[model samples]
Target: MQKLRHSSLAIAFSLLFSLAVQAAERPNIVVIMVDDLGFSDLGCFGGEINTPNIDSLASGGLRFTSFYNCARCCPTRAALLTGLYPHQVGLMRNGNSLTRNGVTIAEALGAAGYQTAMSGKWHLSRTQALPDHQKQLDWLNHQSQPDRTFSPVDSYPINRGFQRHFGPIWGVVNYFDPFSLVDGETPVDEVPDDFYMTDAITQKSVEYIREMSKSEAPFFLYVAHTAPHWPLHAKPEDIAKYKETYRDGWHKLRNDRYQRQVEMGLIDPNTYPKPELQGQGDDWGALDEATRKHMSQLMSVHAAMVDCVDQGVGQIIDTLKETGELENTLILVLADNGASPERYLQPGFDRPNETRAGKPIQYEGLFTPGSETTWGYIGSYWASAGNTPFRYWKAQSFEGGAHTPMIAHWPAGLKTKPGSTTDQPGHVIDVLPTFLELAAAEYPQTFKQNKITPVEGLSLAPILSGQQRAGHPALFFEHEGGKAMIADGWKLVQPKQNGQWELYHLAQDRTETNNLAATEPERLAQMKRQWQAWFNRVKP
Candidate 1:
């Protein structure tokens, strides 16, 4: 009896040790994705924006210079959550639900004994915009539609494996009182007067993190911030910080950001000479005083929104530190798409006629921007500058539309030297696989009685380990007729649907200036075939 008791005690101790080691190996991954952010918007990415918290991630971790997104909001979100291309997951364009067939990172991780929570924009679900424009605006303004359901009940984040979710279901929202805000399945009917979407999203994320830390199981928290995406709304205090920053205008500002990129070794001038001011002849010197002042104010609002996101990042980091999960938690900060050129000149559907307090939301005549009663956008000229040294803006296949800044910080598992940078390309789809690998989770062939498409992303673990792992032989991209393929340092892009194709040796010219299609016909044709084949394969 005594011998048997000693044997049982030894086995129990060994089992507990194994479980503890497994838990330590699995990291708590927190993916923070911002909306319509430019490639060089963050200080770590060579912009003047005050993003010290995100910069700290770049400072203490690694930065990827060639990371890519789907070039739009909903598609990028779908790609990141599932390890599949946007099309494969039924989000080829906006206003679509993430297919049940696509397995989310949360679902995969949760099955592997991990806690899953999300806070912020859950634009994965289809937004039900009323056809009647006024009614839609009323719904968007939260004025008339008290019981409006933005999306299907089963499609919300909580229904898709996230135990806790707090965010808006629609893509565009009035930050002050978002149209489709919800707490899990229940609609958030009222918000405090001082409510700011960025701050609220961060608060809920902090709450989820603190609550989950009590449990032994690792957690996955996706902070999908809807900041810096337009209607150009921002708090006055935050806007004041950058009121005069863009007074120099987009031209000088673009040059300054590019020079900073060159200084930081993120860009090589000779190889990637700044593409000529993309919104050609955007000469700030020639603009009228009023126009110039308005432009600067618009950017200040955009910058202010980003600054608020950084503040949120600080809070998140503080929460992690407080829970003693800082070292073991893997934190990733990136954007959904490139800077938007969406100038809402005509306040149509989803644009409110009045604020929550009955003030008309102004977009014409005379009104200061970044306020609850004003509507504005950081137009293409500014966006061209926003996506500095790159061509085009959001919703295109050009580098500017798809390129994003990605920072990875994992003190316990990351082997890369601090403040180091990598030129290796990574796509949003890779995010799900990276998390799956880190959590020791498997991507299921069938999930919850639905058949899942095979994940189309390579794990970025090898890159984090400081190893030269194989990159995707051919990464494919397509959204609303725009398309691109980046393969082995070569990129082929088509800005317009059914437009002419342009090719470039990305290693030599990432700016897409010198079209090699005229010089390298055979290569261009082959790439066209490859992209077409991929498009066909992904077509649902």
Candidate 2:
């Protein structure tokens, strides 16, 4: 009996050792995505906002200058989650659902034994029907009532392979009192008075991380923050920090950010000349004093939202360190799309005209934004500055709308130099393949017996390891009828839906300032054919 006990103890010890080794081999992954942030919003990316936590990641890892998103919110998320274009996943437009034809990164990694969790906005599905009880709450508050039926169970994050999910099901929500708050499959009807969406999302993420650390298996956490998006909801203390920073106006702000980008080697000042400002010219002095003050306040609120997100990042980093998972963790930070240029408020069942605390919101006239009682947007003037030195804003096919800053930091994985930058052209579709490569996870040919589309992205592992590699032959993009194709530093973009194609040699004129279509007709035709082929393959 004594000999048998000794053998059993030895076997248990060996099993635990094997589990530890496996966990170390597959590093923990945390992908942090922020919404509606411009390319230059983070401090490390040449913006003035305080993003020290995110900046620290860039300082220790690599920053990609030519990374591209889908130029909108839901489409970008779909592409990033699946290793295919958004249209391939049936998300060609904002309200589309994820098709069964594609598998998500979580689904792939979870199948490989990685614990998966997501906290924050899950906008892949259409607006879900509200419960009868919640419908009564909406009616009692004099708010717009939603459809009676709920969203398909398969469309929720939990159904999409997230073992845990805590956030709103819809795309946009009031930061203070969000709609469709869900903890797993159940809806959270009441929230604490101090509950803020950004903070709550981070708190849930930290909790999930801490819990998962107890298990021997590795974990994947997606922290999607809906900060600084719209309605300009920010805490008073955060807003106070930037209330006076934009007093000099956007023209000066744009120039300052551009100069900083050059100084940091993030942009080539000579090759990429600043494009002409989109809306108003660089004449801050001409604006009336009242208009100037209002614009400044709006920007301050926007900056404040970004600041709060950074603070959450700091907390997450601290949690990792405390749990002894810091070194073996891979953290990626990026934005869904460029800065938004939307000027009007679109109130609907999703966007209620009331706060979570039962206060009516005013959408018109000159009222102080960033408060709970008001809804405000930064408009095109500041948006042009937000995407400094780039043309246009979100939803267009221009550089500003599609390009985003991407950061990757992993002490135990990446072999690249610290504080480095890569000019490799990458897209959101590449994210899943990159994560799969790191996790040693397989992208299945079929998931749950449904045939899956093959991944459309190339693994960026070579570039991350300090090796020279040829990237994708060409990247194609189309949204709301606007289309663009980039191949070998030559780009063909159409600003409007079904508009004439304009060509630009991105190597020389990345800003799309000088059109070269007429000069090179043959090259244009070839590229157009390539784009059409791609569109036919992926378009919904």
Candidate 3:
């Protein structure tokens, strides 16, 4: 009897050790995605912006120089979440809902024993089943609708595998008292007087982290921040930091960012020749004094918004340390798309003319921008500067629109030199696969009684581990009518739908300054065929 008891005790001890090993191997995931952020926006990415928290992560981990996005908000989010092309998930355009054809990362990770949670903007679905025009009409009619009654509950984050969620259901909202605020399935009708969306998102994210730290199951937290995008709303002190920072104008700012990027080794000065301004906008020096002041204030607000996001990052990092989860957590920070040049003079339903507190606002005429009652945009000039050496702006297939900065930090998992940059071309679609690889989760052939599309992205695990590996054979992107394809250092791009194809040898001219379309006819033709084939295969 003593011998038998000894054998049983040994077996029990072995099982406990195995379980502990598995738990340690599975690292927690925290993905932070910012909306409409540019390539050179972060301090680590060669921008002058004060982003010490984000920079610290880059300093201690890996930064990807050639990371790509879908060049638009909704499509990028869809690709990042589903690990499939946007069209494959039935997200060909804005307002399109995520179809059952694709499985979300949250669903896959949750099935693999992860506690999934999400906070901030979810632009994957329209609030109502009605046509988009009708939805817009409804929004105009009921500006102060507390609950988004029209939004399908099934489309909310709670039904989409997130165990907990806190954020606005719609794409855009007032920074103070946002519309369609939800906590799981319940709508939060009222907000505190001191509420700011960026700060609120951080609070909820920290709360979730603290709660999940007590559990044995590893967690996946997606913090999607809608900052530095539109309406130009920010706190007074934050905005004050950069009141006249843009006095030198966009031309000089662009040059300055480019120089910084080269000095930081983020870009090769020889390979990436400075690109000419392509978008139609006023030259900085040509603008009147009043217009310059207005533009400067708009940029100040934009910078302030980004500063708030960095502050939130600091809070989150502090929470992870307090919970003793910092060392084992894999943190990734990226942008949904590039900087936006969208401008508005007066507010429409989509762009509210009044503050959350019912204060009337104006975008035109003489009025200080960046206040709760004010609404404005950075316009094309500053947007080009925001993109730095890249050309064009959001909603296009140009490098300026698609290229974004991606940072990865995992002290326990990744084995690479800190502050190093990887030029291995990667896309937003790869995010889901990377998470699954790290968590040891399997991508299901079918999920929830529905057939799911196979993941189109390759796992970035090997690259993160400092291993030399071949990347995707070819990457394709299309939005509205703009399309582009990159394969074997050759890039084929078209500025508009049915537009003439332009070719560039990316290894030589990543900036797209010298077009080789006429010179490399055969290469352009072959790439064009590839792009069309991909479009046919994935189009919804």
Please give, for residues 1-540, the per-residue lDDT of candidate 2 as tens digits. Answer: 865664555445434433543565888999999999978889999999999999999999999989999999999999999979999998899876788899998899999999999999888887543445556446333355444423566788999989999997777777877777788888777788888899999999999999999999999999999887886899999999998999998888889999999999888977789987776443567878887888899999999999999999999999999999989898999998889988656455566656655787877766788876787888887888899879888898889999989999989877789999999888989889877877777789999999999999876766666654456779998898778999989999988645999999999987789999999999999999999999999987
Best candidate, lDDT: 1
Worst 10 residues of 3 by lDDT: 139-148
Report lDDT (Cα) of residue 31, candidate 3. 94
Clashes of 2: 0
Q: How far off is residue 69 in model 3, in Å?
A: 0.7
Per-residue error (Å), model 2, residue 385: 0.6
lDDT of 3 by residue, 183-262 (tens): 98887877888999999999999999999999999999999998988878888889988887877778878888999999
TM-scores of the models, in the given order?
0.94, 0.92, 0.93
TM-score of 1: 0.94
**Model 1 misses residue 404 by how many Å?**
0.7
**Over 4 Å off in model 1, which ranges?**
1-23, 146-148, 280-283
The sequence of per-residue lDDT tens digits that candidate 1 reaches over residues 226-297 is 999998899999999997899988988899999999999988988787897766345677878888898889
Angstrom error at residue 456, model 1: 0.6
For candidate 1, give the lDDT of residue 439. Answer: 77
What TM-score, to 2 decimals, does candidate 3 have? 0.93
